[model samples]
Target chain A: MTERTMTKADLVTSILLIVFSAAVFLISASMPTMAEQNRNPLAAPGIVPGFIGVVLFLLGLAMLIRSVRRGAPAFFAQDRGKPSEVDRSSWGRIALTVGLCLLYALLLGRVWFPLLTFLFVFVFVTAFEYDRKAPAAGQWKVPLFAAILAACTAASVYLVFQYLFLVNLP
Target chain B: MFEGLQLFGQAIVSTFTLRALFDALWSTQLGIIIGMLPGLTATMGVALLTTLTFHMAPNNAILILICMYIGAIYGGSRSAILLNIPGTPANAATTVDGYPLALQGKAGKAIGIATTGSFLGSIIGMLAMVVFTPLIGSVALSFQSFEFVWFSIFGIIICGNLTAPKDPLKGWIAGFLGLFVAMIGMEGIHAYVRFSFGSTNLSGGISLIPAMVGAFGFAEIISVMRVERYEVVKTKIDRVFPKLSEVFRYWKTIIRSGIIGTFIGAIPGVGEDIAAWVSYDVAKRGAKPEEREKFGKGSIEGLLASETGNNACVPGAIIPVLTLAIPGSAPAAVLLGAMLIHGVRPGPLIMIEFPTFIYEVVAMVLLATFMMFILGLSMVRPLVKVLQVPRQKLMPVIFILCVVGSFALQARLFDVGVMMVFGILGYTLREMDYPMAPLVLGIILGDILDKNLRRALILSDGNLAPFFTRPICLALFLLTMFIVLSRAKWFRALLAKIFRKNATA
Candidate 1:
């Protein structure tokens, strides 16, 4: 990221952290001190987290000051209407990967382990390898190869984890 | 000394069995392959394998993990030389000189030197581990709750300071965040759930393995897939061995880098990447004028310094793990977790409970060093093929492992979700230039801090004097303060002004 972008990010992140830390501190303060149990107040569970919350708040404040000193507020205003350098394709790919992973995670216990793994791998590989410029007939090889790899991966992983390692896969 | 030698001998003899040899061979080979592949880091490999090897004997499992650790660090130099990409972060320094040499049609020579340097570096670090661990372990036995609180805080502070040199505030924030993450479940001393928020999984706390596999393994997958592909530079390799005289020419460099590497590795939470960079900087400064000019342009000394330093750091990183239960590096942290899983508690009491275990680790390093040297040089051609496998096909398979590895620990789907959460968080943090090392170290050290601080407070009736007055605690406290103060601009300017006045006087 460019210096301007990083400074802007720092500005935004610091605010979020400050709010988060404040929440943590307040929540920790509300936790029980266990005075009825005759526990040492010094050994109260909330002390460390509260300390951490205060430290985080200070760190966030420091970051906020640093970013402001670097002109993050001005950068935010001056950078408006500029074209973003963000890579949309990369973001798209990441979204696809996350979606597939989430689906796999959600379906893991509900489906057969091997079959689920096979489908996940197949769809992941085929989707990534798909060429939009190519004809549909030419893309058959991509899915075929993905299927083969998916089967091998699913079988080997299943055999290794479930049989050899004796892990009861869900 | 004689007893140590005798135990070392026993360790060597016991570990030399055929089954052990077979395990070492395959695991080291797998480690090398993992290291040669971009995005499959040593930490990830060790974390994933910890789950796979869970059913194995403790000795064998640890042996495999150690072999994997050493082999992977060495293997990263291959991609550094051939593809201009460090297969691991530790090899990032290797690419400066390694790729230049490859461009000069000397890739084979670079690989050979890296392999030999890695071997020698590992040997140096192994020797240091053998000598220092027991001594450190004995000293650590004297530590009380006051000292431990300082130690945990020291680990997080130093790790954050060193790992995020450009902006340490982010590193500290990440570290504190990790410590907070460790606070999510039931408090260790009181059994009070502080931040569970009605979730049973949160009450149980985040499992380190799944969290780690997510942070390093799955995070890496996302980062790797987001980038464009790299083209391998095919070069003809004529020689795979360097002349003895040529290696001897830089004997001083080798020893200096080895020591520097081990020292940096011994520092809690710092790892091989920093070690390599520091060693390279020192080597460049110490080199002759003409040789120094060649530092970034196919200089063998530069390559050797980085490769040796990073490889040496593998053993160096293990020193704190064995002695203090604090990880010296990211991979070492996972290894520490694996040790706990295998019912082998590592800390100061290790000397009393398992005196021979350290020597056995030394022997394991010996075996792994030899295997890495042999496999690194002889199998370069075959291993290059492993790097050629497209990331598109490989990542999905690795993701499968991540899911299963997370689930295999306790057969809980909750861990998988934990992995996903950490993965996304880790990736986002990485994008923001926040170092992950301190964050991870904070998680490992969080329990140590939380439990010990409260214990010390109770012991002292909350006086808070022993925390600053005890000898070790005082030293740690001073050092931590110095580190924090030195980072301030005003403090640095004041130091500079004072030095200028002295010089003028």
Candidate 2:
């Protein structure tokens, strides 16, 4: 019977936001004077910063009040219902992707882009399907699909950018 | 009438060459495949493909990019209908009705309906572009520094409001933040350093590609890794074509969506996703009570409305790009690059510069749509079967491409660093509730918003009056207000009450 909403997170976020907005408003207000001293109109404008800060502060305060009045749904504390029904993507999948991407970035100059991207795409996609209780044939579907996608993408890049455009592929 | 005939004739002559047709077919087909993949996008396809076209004859190159541009947008609907996940941002609206229909074992009907909608939508957009490009171009001719700022702001705001869910305010806030981010490094007006913090690289602000990659691609992938694999429910799809009766039943939805899609696409920076959603909403609201209940559960009209709207947007989006040299979407921006690379400088006087270029473009779009219809119908089952290919081998290949795409941008190791940093940042942000589209729009529109606003002030000797005073500006301001207000619960309720009262009275 748990229901999750963004209100509680909004509550904590709003308080910190109000404080931050006030600080920004103050700093922005001061910067114009500093800019005037330094002869720069770009430093700060009274209407712009004032409008932004006050609005942010008010919005945050309202949200903060709303959060405190209505406690966070118990679902906020746990995964709640079967997550397959939700739009949420999982962390491990995200991590593997980030790692592969980071590895590609790190290897950008030492190796060509096509090589690195292909590896990352293949490994990560395969990893996503690794643990599935599959109908035998489909168990390795993830890796295979990932590989084909990687290969086709790389070959297309080569045919177009390198072969056609004369752009060097890293 | 004679002039129109001649223009069409020129378009045919320019585009009918064997080489041109071949290139168009290949690029369009390639764009279709790229768009069908869930992670790959039309914008990315255009960008990568443009890189390939750089060395070709400008005419052929522009044709390739245009074909890709048209094909990719149309292709996205395939994934939306079959997999229940949009293959491109523009296809997000398609999933709302499309996936539901697939689950109900009506995949073929939905796909066929979507394809027809897309084809008609494209034709409408192209015709609009043909008719209105001159009229709009004339208005743009008078635009200077004074108007560009308002135009840029309008673009960002409209994009923000339309893209975000229940929070156009949040989206605009994010957009303005992006504008602020653009203000970093050297000031556009005088190169007076603002937020560079004295870093020499910061002096030029940030490169556009890195920021885009960081915000969109990198961030998206990161979130993917964080979430373990998702178990998406997908049912088997049969032949994905619609019957004549089914398509005819949704004729009203198709027409309205076409008009709406074209109009939105005409606006700079907005694209297919917005068109689809807006049209879907229109279809839902316009439906009778019985029909309304079927809106999200795969009603043929819902599928038709969104697919038509988004696909039509491609032509609409391209109109402004060709006429004004300002892009209407991310892929259009890439297409602009292709145009510039191909020596086809699109601007207010593009017609004068290259008399038949506009017609050629229209013809290319028409050809691309045909290719999309053919490819999408034939490839659905084969595409699904592609997954039948092993993890270990695939990873290495995908890893290679990622590296190559990044490196090819500038041939600089620094760009690679920029890509990685942004990728990580993108991944992190995805985990949070921050939407990636606004950030991409931000990076894409950042400099335009900053430069134009500053230029407007400098041109006016530092007066902000023109922003609120101009006809277009006034309209945009009101829209922005309405958008923010509508996002509020009270405003929504108030609107509902007003509508209810109006209906009864």
Candidate 3:
């Protein structure tokens, strides 16, 4: 998103914050009071949350007013200085990296950790490397580095976290 | 005094063992490496290492964590100097003077000064810790529930104010939002679930570690990915040690920054970043006209002050952890959790329960400082090479580590999910210019705030007068109000007028 003053993003964020605070207030106000448990009624479970909700709502309202005060046209006007252009290649790489992470997490408990970690790192490194155009030697050099790093990372994680520290990593 | 001296002697003897020395060295080295890595923080280093030291003896484990904490805070200066990207938030101030030094081909000299400043700052902080922990612990004995409530509120307010000086409203929103998040779990007094939305996971409250990992680690990954890379300045290394004469020249800056950092660190929820900024500002104001002009352009005094401030904050942050069970910073928050897991409860009763623990921690911090000093000087060339590593390759690896670190804490996939959610949320919040420190502090202090307020009301039989009238509570409440008021436009204008009058006189 473009970083224009009082841009659409800020307006939306302020509105959402207001909505969230209202929800919190409503939910907290509905919380069951512990009269039967011999607790002080003043110490009801919702007191702090209720106060915080009001504070948040007021803050959000203030932000909304401030955003409105800054020319409303600024919200729609896109400045060239902070462009909101789509970079498909960057987005694709991010998506692939996130996808690989999800797959790694999903297969963790089912697969041996070292092998899974090694393969995931290898795949992720290679994928991102290929996404970027590089020198001719970059192909073999990137792959070699990825393989070595993957092996070292997998082994070290196994040895340090699992064996030495007794952290039961999946 | 005699008892303290005796305990200090015994702690020195105990912590000087081969195992403790080895732990200090290796942990400091690991901490430096982690701190040197962009997107990694001192809090993460402490949290990640907390798991590794689970099986160790209490003192030994705590030592390693302390070393990691100290080293990580010190380590961030390396990247700040070489790459102009602070490895951690605390090093942001360092980047001003440090990176300029790099541009001038004095990276080695800057690193040396930073290393020395860090060592001296840590030593000063350790001394302060030794002196203040017991004093604060004693003073905290009179801190009843009402006092604690105000203290918690004061912590959140002051933290928000310091972190987001430009727009404290966003900081307060983040903090209150964190408080609401903290309220999702079962109530402490009644055991009644507040806002779980019928989910058992929410009823247990959001786990702290995973949420923190997501906020700092995963969120940083996303932010780093979106930003295009910058070319790192290549600088030659001439000297890695400052001359004694040069050290003497900036001695005033170093000592002043160290003391300022230590005091700021002792304040609950405040941390190294604020301390560094405050110290840097003070140093700039105190410099001569020509020297002041050099403040952002690689002034050695500026670099010294910034590094000293942040490094001193490490031990200063720990003082409250040992004294009142209140962490002074995020890393100290993690350290507090580690201490709890290791069955070392730190509070007003710490002295009665474990008399020697404070002294032991002082020794550990001292050891860590020496080790950081040694490793920082020896590994400059190798450590600076980290700046050359491509962010694409490094960030993904860090992402994997973040996953492991989050899950490792509780061995729960649910926590991993929490990390991911907070990561996205944190990134969005960052884009909106909200400060994250106060939010983290609110999460850390929310339970204390809730329980203490309720307990105070219970003791007063539902009367709120004592919350306002009690001496300590009254003082804390007034301080909090002052902080909130000082930010008002009128109040700022009045202060500016007073300063103007004073200058005219």
lDDT of 1 by residue, A5-61 (tens): 999999999999999999999999998888779988898889999999999999999
Candidate 2 Cα outliers beyond 4 Å, as residue runs: A1-89, A110-170, B1-5, B92-106, B225-246, B287-298, B324-326, B337-356, B379-381, B387-402, B485-505
Of the true interface contacts, the fraction found in model 1 is 0.80
Best model per TM-score: 1
Error of 1 at B220 (Å): 0.5
How do the residues B1-505 of candidate 3 rate in per-residue lDDT, one tens digit apiece? 7889899989999899998898898999989988887778898788767755667888889999999999999999998998898988899999999999999999889999999999999999989988889888889888888888888888888888877888787888888887777887787788888787798878888977778778877777777776667666778887998887887798889899999999999887789999999999999999989999999999999999999999999999999888888889888988888899889999888988998889988888889999999998896887777677887778767777888887777787778788888887897798788887788878877888888887887799888899899888888889988888897779999999999999999
The candidate maximizing DockQ is 1
Name the candidate, 1 or 2, with the larger TM-score value.
1
Q: Model 2 over residues B1-505: C-alpha lDDT tens digits? A: 4786688777877677888768877888787766766656777677655544556677777778778877878778877876676878889989988888888887777777888888888888877877887678778777675566556666666776766665554456455545545555665444455455677766666655555544555554444344333234456777677678878887788889999999988776677788888888898999888988988787888888898899888888888888877677767766775686567888777877886788888878777777777766676666654432332343344334444545565565665666677667665444435455555556545565556655566566677788778877777777767766777789999999999999999
What are the Cα lDDT values of the candidates? 0.92, 0.67, 0.84
Please state the error at residue A16 of candidate 1 in Å.
1.0
Compute DockQ for each candidate against the true complex.
Answer: 0.84, 0.27, 0.51
TM-scores for candidates 1 onward, in order: 0.98, 0.79, 0.93
Docking class of 3: medium
Q: Ranking by lDDT, best first?
A: 1, 3, 2
Off by over 4 Å in 3: A1-7, A72-74, A77-97, A110-112, A131-138, B490-505
lDDT of 3 at B215: 83
Candidate 2 reference-contact recovery: 0.36
Model 1 lDDT per residue over B1-505, tens place: 7888898999999988898888899999999999999899999999999988998899999999999999899989999999999999999999999999999999999999999899999999999988898889999999999998898888889999999998988989999998999889998888999788999889999888999999999999999998868898978876988887778799999999999999999998899999999999999999999999999999999999999999889999999999899999999999999999998899989999999998998899899999888888796777778878999999999999999999998999999999999999999999999999998898889899899988999899989899999999999999999899899989999999999999999
Q: What C-alpha lDDT does candidate 2 achieve relative to the native structure?
A: 0.67
